[model samples]
Target: MGHARANGDRRVHHRVDLDGRAVVFQRGAHVGQYALENLSAGGAFISGERELRPGHLVHVLIDFAAGNPPMSMTGSIHRVREADNGVSLAIRFPVLSADQEDAIQDAVLRTLLRREEQAARLPLLVFEPRPRVRQEIEAEIRSFGLPVTSVESLDEAVRELEGEEVEYAGLVIHSATHDRASMEVVEFFARTESLQTIILPEPDGELNDMAKRLSTLPHVSVPRIWSRSELRRALRN
Candidate 1:
C-alpha cells in the first residue's frame, strides 16, 4: 500500500507500471473504466475523473497487458489525492488468497521480463533479521559456491527482488521472521511454475511453527536442521 503507507518509507512488495484499465464497481454498480497503473501483488492505483472516497469498498476487473484476460480483484480505497487532471485513488488489497497473489506477481514479472531485459544471474537471497543467524545462512550459501545477497528485513529483500540486476535462484528465510510479513513475501515467490526455490531454515526443538506451516506449499522447503546436503538440495531444487 505504498500510495497510502504514510508512516514510513518501507515497502515489502514491488510495484510495476502497467498499461492497464480497471472496471471498478461501487456498491455493486458499475463505475466504468478507470486508467490503471502502478500494479503490484499487494494493490493497484487507478485514476479517473471520478472521485472515490477513501474507505469505500470496490470490486475491480483489471485488464492488464500481455494478452491475459481481465483478472477480478477486490480492494478498498485507501488513499485519494487530487491531481491536475483528476483524482487518483489507491486501492489496498486485503486478505488475498495465495493463488491470487501469485497471479498478480506473475503478471508483474511478465511485464518486467518483456522489456528486453535479461534475467540477473542466479544468486541466493537470504532474509534473516538476526545477525548471528544471518551469518550462518550466508556461510551456508557460500559453502555451495553460490553468490549470496543477504538482507535483514522484508523491505530490503523486496528491493533486491525488484532490482533488474539480480535474478535470484533461491530464497532462504529464517524461521523467526514475523509470520504475516514472511508469508506476504513468500507468496510472491512460491509460484506454480516457478524456477525459484524457497527454503525456510527450520531448526529442531525451536518455536518455529511457521517453518513447518510454510513447508506445506509446493515450492517451499523446511529441513528441520541444516546439513550441507540438505541445504544444497533445497537451494538447487
Candidate 2:
C-alpha cells in the first residue's frame, strides 16, 4: 500500500509544473479560463468554478513548451474538495504505456532541468464521463467538450465499453453504487490484458479512507494531479 507523505518530503509533488495556462476540464467542455496550480508525471490539480466529483473520468490536453501542438490523454478523478479560492481536484492517469510513461517522465524532467524553459502550453481540453457522472460532472465537462453518451446504469456502461472496437487505454471506476461491480470489472480486465484501473472514492470521501479502500487492489496506480501538463506527463510515465 502507498502512503501519502506529510508536507516536508513532497519531492514527487514538487516535480509538478504549475503555471496559469494549463487546461481546465470539468464537464463536457473545456474551461479555458481556469488557472493551473501544479503538475507531475502522475496527475494534476487545478482551480475552477465547479467541483469535480471523485471517480469521474477525464481527458486532458497538454502542450508543454518542449513540444509543438498539445497532446491529449485520459485520467480519473481521485479527489475533489472545496478550497478557499475554488474547488480543487487531484487526478490520476491510468491509460499509459511503458514507452509513453518514459517519454512523459523525460519530458517533465527536461522541462524541470531547463532554467529558461517556458511554461507548457495547454489545449482547451474536453472532458467526458460515463453516464452515471453526467449530472454532477457534466457542467465541468461542458467547459471542455461534449461527450459521446450519457450512460446511467451498469448495463449501459458495459454496452458502451463493449461496443468500442479498440482496446481502451484506461478505465475510471466510481466507488459509489458500483463498488462491487467496479472491482469485478478490474478483475475481468486483469484476466484479459494489462489494464490500469483508477478507483475514485465517492464524493466527500476522506483521502485516508479512500486510500485504504483502494490499497491491495491489483493493477491500479494513483497520482495526484494539478495541471494538464502533469496529466500528460503521467500518461507517458
- Local distance difference test values of all predictions, in order: 0.74, 0.51
lDDT of 2 by residue, 88-192 (tens): 777676555445455556666666656322212211111124544544443432333322233555565555556655334445444444545545654566446
Shift in Å, residue 166, candidate 1: 30
The local distance difference test score of model 1 is: 0.74
**Residue 133's C-alpha lDDT in candidate 1?**
81
lDDT of 2: 0.51
Worst 10 residues of 2 by lDDT: 118-127
Give per-residue CA lDDT, model 1, range 1-237, as digits (tens).
753563122225778887788999988999878888788766898898889889999999998867656789888999999976888889998756666776777777787776523333467788888899889879988887778889988889878877888677667776666577676667666663353545555455243665566677777776656667777777655
Runs off by more than 4 Å, candidate 1: 1-11, 117-237
lDDT of 1 at 160: 83
Instruction: Give the TM-score (vs. native) of candidate 1.
Output: 0.45
* Runs off by more than 4 Å, candidate 2: 1-14, 24-28, 31-33, 65-69, 116-237
